[model samples]
Structure formats: C-alpha cells, structure tokens
Target: MNMMSMSKLSLLSVLLIAHCSTAASDLPKDVFILAGQSNMAGRGGVSSGKWSGDVPPECKPDPSILRLNAKLSWEVAHEPLHSDIDVGKTCGVGPGMAFANEVRLRANESKIGVVGLVPCAVGGTKISDWEKGTRLYSELLRRAHVSVSGGGVIRAILWYQGESDTVKKEDAQAYQGKMKKFIMDLRSDLNNPSLLFVQVAIASGEGRFVDSVRKAQLGINLPFVKCVDAKGLRLKDDHLHLTTMSEVHLGIKLAHAFLTTLK
Candidate 1:
C-alpha cells in the first residue's frame, strides 16, 4: 500500500482505540446485580407524575446510583430499575436504589466509586426458570460478563424470588436444592467462587406452599451466602407484592447483608 493509504489506516486505528478506551473508562467499577421475581422487579406504588401513585422522596433517584440500561450502557438508575426485563407495564420503586444508596453511605473513608446496578429480574419467574443454561440464565450471565469486560465490577448479586414456587408443593419442596444450585452455578460462571450472594426470602405470595418456600429460603446455608428474612414485611393491597415502604426496608436489609460480607 502507498504511504498515503497506510497513514490514513493508522490514524483510523488510533481513533478507534481511543474511542474504545473512553467507553470502558466510563463504566463503573462497583456493580451490583439485582435478580429475581416480582418483588425484586417491584410492584411498589409510584407517585411520579409519569406513574400511578406516589413514590416517596427517599425512594427517588440519586445521582450516585447508576444502572445498566436497555442498550447495555451505564445510566442514572431510577425506579422500576428493571424496565427492560418486561416485568411490568410501568416501573415502580424496587430495592435497588435503596440498597445502592445505603451502600454509598456505608462505604466509609474510602470514597464509594460509581455504583452500577444490573437489573436482571423478571417478575412472576420461578427458580426453575433461572436454571443454568436456561434462557434467563444466559441473558443474565451475558449481561454480567459484558459489564465485567467493560471494566465494571461485579460486587454482588441481590436475589429476591421464590413466590411462584409457592404455588406447587413439589416446587416448594425442591426450592432449597434449586436455589443452592443456582447460586453455585452463578458464582462458578462468574469465576468468583467467593462472590457474595445476598438473597431476600419470599415475602409476598398466596399459596399453600408459601411457608414451604420461606422455610427453604431460611434453610439455605452456603459459604459467602447470606439470606435475609422478609416473611413479616407488609405488602401492598394486592397482597402479592411488597409495599413501597417494605421494599425500602428490604433494600436496607439487603444492603446490610451485602456490606457485612465485605467485612
């Protein structure tokens, strides 16, 4: 090739490298994954002008909290954090923002770097739906690996599911085993065997096996895993989801569990 053509090609390669570097630098180094069912997707009432009811100020968005958007890009995180997940017609408050806010507060002298929350939860989903190699698993795992590859960190995965399993005795009976396998597989795939896995016990449901799911949740005892109770948390009018306030509380609980693991 002539010198003119070679020079132009070199310049183009330089520009491309710079652009890629800039994008990777923009990614957050601290990220949390939010995964589970409706409660995790959240049906808490909204008060925003764009939504149905009211969302308290505390539950509102914070600049410090960031999320992986539909385009797989980092953006300011807000309620209904998992909109792209198709969990609801409109997003409402979830524990993500709350948990993130609390994490920032407790980061101590070390400044909390940019926080990225990866919302992969699908409402009404059962534990079986997230089995390794399943569609949901692949999607979630893909998102996470992409985030990490882009220089973002995978600090923890906050899971709040199990309601759907409450509908069947067999589902409930096998909940513990399924849940244990999911966590192990998830950590293994992430290549972080000691990754902190924080989970919220089934808090809202209407089925004969509700308590069974709860019992299974409580029975989970894995290293680097912590399960927070949610059985007594108040629910919304539907009685199948957590109330806005309860979600906030649950977020705090999750944040505490996650932080404790870091110690």
Candidate 2:
C-alpha cells in the first residue's frame, strides 16, 4: 500500500527469481546407459533392504529405473529395461539405483543428473547379434545417439552380457573383435572417444559357458572399458540370475570402476 512497502516487495521478488534461475542452471544432464541380457532385465524379486526407504511416493518400480532429479525436479532415467515381461504383470529391480547413489556420493555438489537408459539388449543375444545395420543393433545405436545429442552426456555404459556366445568356443574368441567393433562404433557415433564402459563378468551357473563367456568379455579391452566380477555374489533361485542384493553389489562395483576411470 505504501511506497516503501511496494519497493521492498519488488526487490524480494527479483531476488527470488534470480535464485531460482541459478539453481536450475546448476543441475546436470548426465546419462548412464545399461545394456545386456536377462540379468540386466532383473529376474530377481524386489528386496526389502533395497526397495525399502525414503523412495519418493511418485516413484514406481519397473524394468527401468526412473527417478526425480533432486536439483532440477525433472524425471531423469536411471537403470535399463524395455518391457516388464511378456505376461505383463511383474517387474523387478536392478542395480541401477545403487549405481546412481554411488555417483551422487562421489560427485557431490556436481551439476549432473542421470538420464534415460537406452536398453537395446535382447535376452538371448550374442555379440554378433549387435552388428551394425542389423535391426536390433541399429535401433540401439539410434536411441543412444539421440540421448547423447539431446543435452545429456554419456557418462558410462553398463554391459552384462556374453552368456549366449560361450557355448561355441569359436564364437567366444570372436567376441572380443565383435565387442571391440561395437564399442568403436558407439564411441564414433557419440563423438566421445573417452566414453566409459563397465562390463559385468558372467557368474557361475549351471551353464558350461560361464567361464568361457566371461573370458571373452574381458578380452575386449578398450581404454575406457572395465570389467566387474559377479562371481561369488548371491544369485537368484534360478542360479543364473543375480539376486537384488547381488545386483546392488554389482552396481556399486561398476560405479567404483567409473569413479576410478574418472580419476
């Protein structure tokens, strides 16, 4: 009502607007990619330990891990998963949460938020299945490129495949070459030669291909790629899949590798 009061109100409003704008600019747009087979799809049921906590009420558990960016208030993608299941009623949690948590811990105060995880991994696919120009591989690359160019940095790629290729020893040996090619293509397309890749080693299971497949996975050594061992971690009842606890452990390991690479 008074001139003095009106002047004070205007100054307060200006300051409020400036603060909000600065906060928004400080939020990050980083992207973490998850790729691979059934394990990454999360076959284990959700655990009380991991799922229980201060998860925002709006959050839902599906194949993908979608969470709110605390700083920006935007929906940033975390984990990786395309479909829930063919039956259409069940979903499982993966290690993406643990990975994201670790990133936040390591990069405190950094203006970076995780974004959409473009999961193009088929359950029973081999390294050869991801060849360039193929329907599946092409789609994967397209999605990845879009995510990278759309104001999101490709922070890292989480890979957990190779079980299918181990049955054939010859295929195992060729896996390194195929994987190398795939990584090269990804780097070229994203225009980031230093893109980081974190891979999961196959855990022991009923399949005879476990050791062989893991060996092949390790053979593809790009400067940015590192392998995380999944052996000895608790697995699901199926003996082939990782339990929620194991998934979390795997995720932490992968996150540690990412931190190391950054250093």
Candidate 3:
C-alpha cells in the first residue's frame, strides 16, 4: 500500500480504539431487574383495610437511580417502581426503590456511572405466568434486553412472587420446580451464568398455602440464588400486603443479600 494509505489506516484504527474505550467507560454496569407480584411492586402506605398513609421518607424518589418508565424509557426512579407493569390497581411502593437506593449507596454512584432498575412486577400474578414462554416472561426478557441495550450490564434480578400461587395447593406444591426452571431459563436467556437471583420468601396473610410457597421459595437450592425471609414482617391492614416500614426492611434485606452474594 502507499505510505499515505498506510498512515490513514493507522489513524483510523487509533480513532476507533479511542471511541470504543470512551463508550465502554461511559456505559453503566449495575442494571438490576426487580420483578415479581404486588409485594415486589410495593403497596406501602396504601391502606386497604381501614387506615390510610403516605409514602415514608426512606422510600422516596432518588435522582441517582434510573427506572424504566411506562413509555419504556429511563427516568428518575420513584415509588411504584413497577408503575408501567402494574395495570390492576394503582402502583405503590414496593422494595424496589429502597433496594436501588441501597445499591447506589454501596456502589458509590460517583465512581460508577449509575444504577438502572428495570421494574417488571405485576400485582396478583402467579408463578405459572412467569415461566419461560408466557407473555410476562417474554416481556421481562424483552425489557431486560432493552434496559441493558443502552450499554449497561444486568447485575441481578430481584424476584418476589408466589402469593397467587399459594391460593391453590397444586400451584404451591409445584412452585419449587417452576421457580427453579424460571431461574435457569432467565439466566440462560440473559446469558449471564453467574447472575444473582434474589427471591424474597412470601409474607403472611397472602393465602392458605403460604407455607407451601415459602417452602418452595426456600427450596430453590441453586448456586448464585439467595432467599430472604419475609415471613414475620409487619403487614398492611389488608393482611395481604406489607406495610411501608416492613417494605423498607425487606428492601434492606434484599440489598444486603444482593451486595454480599454478588461477586
């Protein structure tokens, strides 16, 4: 090749390398998917029995954490983290916001780019729904891909479900296998072998087969899969959902598990 052509090629290579490096540095590395049922979506401060309340201070919105909004776009994450997916009643505070805040505190947003939370929880859903090929499952996969498509990496999946499954003995009994399969499928599809899947054991007042679901949740014995206890947490007056304080505590537990096991 001519000297000028060779010089141009070398310059192009250097410029390409520089661009790639800058992009890599700019992209985020801590995108977490918070998916599950109502509790995972949060019903804190929303009274159903008799009393009403407001969102507490700890679980308020944060500027550092970004959530995938209903428009399928990223924006400042706030309460009702699953606003888009929560189609039933209005969305409320679940453990998601608190969890993201804790992660931000630990990850040090100033150093890393930011924490991106992908909320995909729907109220009153069953484990049967989130299996591999169902609509919810497909949507979760699609959202997860689109979420990290912006260049961030999927750090973990915060999963809290099975309340609906607990209604039927059969569903509760079958939860362990279904849940195990769901985790395997999620990891396989995401292509993250060591992905962190944190499952929050169900709280009380949800159903008659709560124990069965709890056993199944705890029974999901797999590497990189951790379980957090929510059996005795304070529940809302409805006796089905968690109170704001309990939700915050649950978020703390989830965050601790995520930060500790993630290596």
Candidate 4:
C-alpha cells in the first residue's frame, strides 16, 4: 500500500480506538444485578393489569443511578425500574431503585462512583426457569456481561424470588438445593467466586408452602451471601405481593444488608 493509504488507515484506527475508549469510560463503575420473579420485577401498587403510577420518595429516580435498559444501554434509573426488562408485566416499584439510591447515599464517602442496576427479573418465573441453560439464566448472564463489558465492576447481585416454588410441596422441599446451585453456577459463570448476594426471603406466595421456601432461603449457608427477611412487610389486598410501602421497606432492608453486612 502507498503512504497515503497507510496514513488514512492509521487515522481510522486511532479514531476507532478513541471512540471505544469514550464509550467504555461512560459506563458505570459499580454495577449490581437484579434478578428473580414477579416480586423482584415489582408488583407494588400494581393491581389487576395496571400500575398506580405512584413512586415513593425512597424509590425516586436519581441521575447518579443508572439502569441497564432492555436495549443493553445505560440510562438514569426511575421507579417501575423493571418496566422495560419485565416487558408484559405491569411493574410498579421494585427494590432496585430504592436499593441503588440508598447505596449511593451511604457510599458518598467512598469512591463508589456511578451505580448501575441490571434488571433481569421475569415476573412469575420459578426457580427451575433460571437453571443454567434456561432462557432466564442465559439472558441474565448476557445482561450481566454487557453491564460490565465496558470496564465496569460487578459489585453484587440482589435477588428476591422463590414465591413460584412454593406452589408445590416437592418444589418447596427441593428449594434449598436448587437455590444453592443457582448461586454457585451464577458466580462461576461470572467468574467471581466471592461475588456478593443479597436475597430477600419471601413474605407471601401463591401457594401454601411459603414457610418451606422461606426456610430454604434463610437456610442457605453459602459464603458471601446474606438473607433479608420480609416476613412482617405489608402485602397488597390480594395478599400475594408487597404493598408500595413494603417494597420501599424491603429495598431499605436490602440496602442495609448490602451496606452493613456484605460490603
């Protein structure tokens, strides 16, 4: 190639590298994965097929807090945080925004920069649906990798699920084992053996085996894991999902667990 052609090619390469560097630098420095089912996807202030459109102060959107949108890009996070990711579900308030806001407030003294939440929860999904090879699992891992692909660091995964598992006696009985495997496989895939996990023990379920599932949740003895009980949190009229206030409380609890225990 002539010097003119080579020089043009070198300029193009330099521009490409500069563009990539800028994009990577724009990514959040602290990333957290939010995964689970309906409750995790959020049902607060949601009844029938609609959300009340009310966002509590604790769960308000913050410019410093970002969410990995369904398009796999970062945007300032707001309430109904899972709306885009959960798709068909009428997402109201989830622990994600509140949790992120709380973390940001408390971590102001630390060097914890921008906070990014990767929402991967699907409403009404069972633990079985999130097995290593399942769609939920794959999407979750994919989103996770994408979240941190641009030089961001995955701080932890905030989990709240298992209500679906309470539907059957056998499922409840096997909850602990499945849950443990899920956590292990996730950490293995993420290649972070010490990745933090803050799980919310179920407060209500669609079936009779609520206690059994909660027992399994609290019974988990894995390292770098913390379980926050939602036993006394208020539920909605349906007696299945938490109320708006309860979601806020749960978010605070999750934040406390992460800040005080896991951090």
Kindly indicate the candidate among 2 and 3 with the higher lDDT. 3
**RMSD, every candidate, angstroms:** 3.2, 7.1, 5.8, 2.8
- Where does model 1 exceed 4 Å of error? 1-23, 46-50, 87-89, 109-111
C-alpha lDDT score of every prediction, in listed order: 0.83, 0.64, 0.82, 0.89
Clashes of each: 5, 1, 2, 0
Cα lDDT of model 1 by residue, 74-177, tens digit: 78888778777744555577888888888888867435677889989887789999999899999999889877777767988999998899888999999999
**Reference-based TM-score, model 4:** 0.91
Clashing pairs in 4: none
Better of 2 and 4 by TM-score: 4
- Of 1 and 4, the candidate ranking higher by lDDT: 4
Candidates, ranked, lDDT: 4, 1, 3, 2
Candidate number of the best lDDT: 4
Please give, for residues 127-232, the per-residue lDDT of candidate 3 as tens digits.
9999998999999999899888867888789998888987788888999999998999999999988888999998863579999889888888799999999988
Q: What's each prediction's TM-score?
A: 0.87, 0.72, 0.85, 0.91
Task: Provide the lowest-lDDT 10-residue window in model 3.
Answer: 47-56
Q: Show model 3 residue runs off by greater than 4 Å.
A: 1-28, 48-53, 108-113
